[model samples]
Target: MVNITKDTEKEELIAQFWPQISRAAAGYENRPALSDELAQEMALSVWRSLEGFNDQCSLSTYIYRVIHNTAIDHIRRHSKISEDELDEAMLCESPTPEKNTLQAQRQKQLIVAVNQLPLSLRQVMLLKLEDLNNIEMSEVLGISEANVGVRLHRAKEQLSKLLAGMN
Candidate 1:
């Protein structure tokens, strides 16, 4: 296994995990512009926190914690401003010509549904999407493994209801 060293470039590390960072940010902020900004903030935060990464857990777990923490910060910073409610009609009935594929449309709908979930559930769902197991999620979230399982179960149930409503 290649070990991370001080000489490892931040650009390389960020590039490797950009997809995860972006996805986590998008889960927190439905607005693409704000999500992009959050992802950038996460990348910078990861670089700054790299020195503190003692290998107590997997590197991916550490990165997720950083990204999620940054997302929480973003939410707190913008808490005073009310976000526009997502229209249920817009979630499913958007017949935009550009997005022609059925799968793409469904994916977009799922993302919208996920974004509508409460923050606690949303965090678990997003990390679950990243393929993190309960233990890993608990470590990153600072919650118990049992709590992770409960949250994941709740997230799935809510997502199902949300998606069902869309159909």
Candidate 2:
């Protein structure tokens, strides 16, 4: 297994995976400020953990596992936030120049649904969204492949229900 030994390698990994990391962070937090804060925390965590990253899994899986774990911890620590504080913390997602209003609105609805999913389901769904196969997701999450499939199936069902309700 190749060991991570250089700052440049670390920088390259971060640059390459930043979009996935950003989306995962934003998808986890659902609030712009918190998402940015969460993403920064993820970057720092990934930077520190670089030396320990064994090449057993793909870099994508490893980085995602770190980000997901960090996001979970952040959520746990902030669990005591009040309803009003949560409302105050909420922010709309930023608009992408290429996406029109209808597209943006649909995307927003999807994001909201994703954020509302239980973490296990969300993790599997997010990883799947990034095009990881069942094996990679299972390895990254330390769950059985069967479990990943079950969770994904349930998550998709839930998401469909959620979108249906929104319509």
Best by lDDT: 1
The local distance difference test score of model 2 is 0.83
Q: Model 1: residues >4 Å from true position, as ranges?
A: 1-8, 80-98
Cα RMSD (angstroms) for every candidate in the order listed: 3.4, 2.6
Residue-by-residue lDDT tens digits, candidate 2, 1-167: 87887999999988888898898888778556778999999998898888998887887788888888898898887653444554555444344674556887788778778877888898998888889899989988899999999999999999999999989
TM for candidate 2 is 0.87
Off by over 4 Å in 2: 80-100
lDDT of candidates 1 onward, in order: 0.84, 0.83
105 Cα displacement, candidate 1 (Å): 1.0
Query: Clashing residue pairs in candidate 1, if any?
Result: none
